[model samples]
Target: MSTSTSADPRERILILGAAGRDFHDFNVLYRDEPRCEVVAFTATQIPDIDGRTYPPALAGPLYPHGIPIVDESGLESLIARERVDTVVLAYSDLAHTQVMHLASRVVAAGADFVVPGAHRTTLRSRRPVIAVTAVRTGVGKSQTTRHVATLVQSMGLRVVAVRHPMPYGDLAAQACQRFETPEDLVRHDCTIEEREEYEPHIDAGVVVYAGVDYGAILREAEAEADVVLWDGGNNDLPFYVPDLHIVLADPLRPGDEAAYHPGEANVRMADLVIIAKCDSATAEDIAAVEASVQALNPGAEVLRCDSPVTLDDPAAVTGRRVVVVEDGPTLTHGSMSFGAGVVGARDAGASAIVDPTPFAVGALADTYERYPNARGILPAMGYGQGQTRDLEATIRAMVDAGVVDAVVSGTPIDLTRVLTVDVPLVRARYSLREQAPGRLQAALRRALGR
Candidate 1:
């Protein structure tokens, strides 16, 4: 094996067998590395080889940026002329033999051979960050975050949950302690100590910091946690970049007209598109939604779920709702919602919280317009004097509207009116309720049947 001094910073690294996603990976790895400068790309000839350009220039027209494409025929001459010292072979198993041959030839020309081991180096340096966002609020953005976080945590890995456009609060405080303001969470690497003085909150062996920007929180969590889950988006196109992204669809909301447009951009960036509220959707509606998602994200996986599945046994549901609270606003809200769901189920003799929004009844009725069982309910939104009254009103409206079987909110509202008006209220900060792991896991088990 020919060897060169590892300390040499000027070594010309020639990337071989680059194609498709592998090529993209190579570009990301050395795009800004101080020591590595990718000078050229080379590929081997196969049967009926298309004369298309290699390393397909990222920018410009035709050849683009003047990055020369070399085949096996021009390998030796190009290597010699470029004074290439190191070769980085980025090829799959099928091209391994061809890459080895090229390495041998390069080494014979008085250069060093660097075989990138088969042990997936990309996964190590390239953390797959996924941003969960919604077109608008109250569309289950926070609920989706909790569900995804639970899935990630169940995979035997650590996860950090962050709720953006909000501030971090105390998970232990009974009255919900607001520690740092939203602005403080936006700063890069803002020391944890500067904001709040509290004990650490760990979930499935992973430490979680609630209420931070999706990007900033992910960066911090990526340093320590295996995966990070963002609860909300602060602004449009929250980040210029992301590995994968998801957008939740809420059919019950009337103002969702603006959602589909932003979804166009989000779909372009997403590796998968998930359609929520599937239970209330018709076959034609599901098909339409799928087509919409596919138009933006071609070849992206689309998963649909009507509502989170409830644990079969009451004990499981009770355990998930009544115990094990996670840190963060999203989680806290999720927990409260789940607890309310459990309460609703118990009171109504129902299995789960069905249609937890006042508008859900109208939406469901419209969806099942032809069905005889279809019904509509106009819920009352009560703005009470105290927090408890507000919470009660929200829960009562939801329950009476047939949106929620049980109510969960910070304040209390009169449910007596719900019986007459067909609406029930569940009062709780939804952002905090969705953070609880038990709630998430229960919801996932209910939704995905896993």
Candidate 2:
């Protein structure tokens, strides 16, 4: 979309977001532009992210009185009351039809519906960048990112990982977050989902940066790196331009590569498309995904890989009925019924997977109703302390009533850190492994000009 010009009167703006993209757009494109005044930010898609101000410290000198972050439902009224002249849709993972519906609503409210393109929003880095994005959430983006980082390290280059924004707390403090140690997570008050992504990268001795302002985050990361790896979130595009744009496709959901919102864009833009979890998919499914990618982007290179699943404690899961606790976004908005945990439990000889619905309490129960596709697996939905406590209580109640013998968690971080479980809790872990022998190495060599 065309940015507001100097000739245009100073436009009052309302940003539509889910916390991540909203802040990035403002910081990179609108913060100091002088041609636009962002009246408010509207949040959705993640819980407990609304009702806070986008603190003035990060809002820059232009907005001395910070920007209000209101709930998305009040978009129309806010537009009318605040006299918002523009509404920028700055979030991702939305279908095209859904995007248009919002656009229609914005137009009806007499405001220009703006979606800043990649050029206006994506940052350019000093170091060579490699971005790992996916066709959708839960399609092995994390493992693929780790694989790229590991590859970069193997080449003896310092690589800093800059994750897509998940700034759900104090905007000022989170303007540029750095996570180098487990304690840093506590220092930043990272949510469970944030910990999942950050802790693993920290374990690898890689500094991970995120927060409201990506330009600031990038500068911090670039100072100590030979390469910057953009570990993307959801199915969102990268916040920086890359030397190598590696996108992932899931064979389990074959046609999604060409069908989903920005996923189709990723497939078309990718330098390489790695069809992940091929070993787990049927031959037909694998072929179907490859065919779709080939048709969508005829020149893109395709690699085969698998997110091989394993359990941290397989013995505890053997010969028992278990409850599967999956990644929150995966089972919820990601729309995956089972995650690595379920696969691990099944492989470890679990007799059955207990459906947690009957025993779920509070927000835990609400999750089941919300995602009917939850498929008996419990989603680990702890955006805040209340939700975290509810997760613990649900698991405790289930174990007490003997709903299952063990709990298999497919969540990335160790759940025991937050929940006290009476019975054995098995953790599921998965990592990216190339199916094609030297494809990844060759690609990396080309990317780094080795």
Candidate 3:
């Protein structure tokens, strides 16, 4: 068979094994391609291939028009008759070999064969790194660090949450022990007390020790974790260059001088700046911050977050939950790591918190006005990393905004450590399995009444 006529713009494309998630992705890719048109779908007549019904097949009577399903015997004739120019293999892993064989045949038959780009793999022993810093203290950086850790763990990757050096607090030390894996330390039996012997910060009520050797903690954590979330203290720069720098700022801090100043050194390093305490800031205040941040870092993206937003809340999340994961120069600088407690809560069928501000609940109210039934909200607070005054203000803001919710966190500090803060705390060790996408999705679906 041969084509008697031809069109200049539309190229006939043959899609093979178009009956699964791979096909769905292809559909999305080709939906708006003006130069390529998928004309047919071909597959073998085996039980594995033929027995399964096409799940959510592409919509018909659309741009691609009707997709003719063809078998192996009919493939050559169909291609000739339809004047197909290219063949695309859309089979999943189990059927990859079959698709390859079919593509070989298509190429031999005088048609171009297109395979998707090879999956890029990084051979580095180190994992990706992401630095989590705040423009100042009390912007819920600790909480957000935990959340990112959970997210990474969900991706089937190990993670370590690192904090800047500080005066060691027993609670912080104990929290570190809880997150430390047996292999992270020289010996599994090494107690926090023994671990802190070489470092005096343990008794200072600030620094905690998670298992891995302190000298190589960052490197080891980077290698073990798919992503490492480094919690940088005020005016501290993480040792490694970050692929992405996240700066959390609390807009409600009392003095304007304490707020994020565009001229400040820290703000200049941020790839993304999130203004916390959105509920406490007036419109004028928000605008001022935005203008200042833009002036300081023209390339950086700024986001505003309020606390206590829920799935049922109609006034939350006007924007899509835009998340980007990448691997770069140093594994530690590229990805964000989430904590184990957050993962456990999501896996245990609890709603995930997504706040990063004191007035997160109020910001959520505004978000609901734009997007009703947002899946989750990022709340900001509960981890110890701010001045007493700032912490009190954050707690008060949450209360004023009616943001009451339990939170999960992990620290190198002692497990016995407890905070008498206003909100409930559910502390646990960190792990990778609890934050899986399916688990999180299911939890959100249940929360949003899906």
Task: Write the residue-wise lDDT of candidate 2 on 1-450 in tens digits.
Answer: 123354668888889988888888888889998988898889887987888888889889988778888899987888888777889988877767888999999999999998777777888999999999989889998878888888889999999999998887777888888899989999998888888888889988899999878888889999999999999998888899989999999999888887776788888889999999987899899999999999999999999898899998898999998999998998877788988998899999998899888888888888887788985898888788788888889888888887789999998888888778888988899999888778887898898898
TM agreement with the true structure for every prediction: 0.38, 0.96, 0.35
- Worst 10-residue lDDT window for candidate 2 reads 1-10
Q: Write the per-residue lDDT of candidate 3 for residues 217-316, one digit (tens) a residue.
A: 4544554455555665442334345666676654554223133221144567777766655654587777777677777778876776653222222122
CA RMSD of all predictions = 20.0, 2.9, 25.2
Q: Per TM-score, what order, best first?
A: 2, 1, 3
* C-alpha lDDT (0 to 100) for residue 12 of candidate 3: 78
Model 2 residue runs over 4 Å out of place are: 1-8
Which ranges in model 3 have alpha carbons more than 4 Å from their true place? 1-125, 167-178, 181-214, 254-263, 309-450
Put the candidates in lDDT order, highest first: 2, 3, 1
| Candidate 1: Cα lDDT at 165 | 25
Top of the candidates by lDDT: 2
| CA lDDT scores, all candidates in order | 0.40, 0.87, 0.43
Model 1 off-target regions past 4 Å? Answer: 1-126, 168-207, 211-219, 233-240, 251-261, 309-450
How many residue pairs clash (N, CA or C atoms closer than 3 angstroms) in each of the candidate models, in the order given? 58, 0, 60
Best by TM-score: 2
Error of 3 at 293 (Å): 1.0
To one decimal, what is the Cα RMSD in angstroms of model 1 from the true structure?
A: 20.0
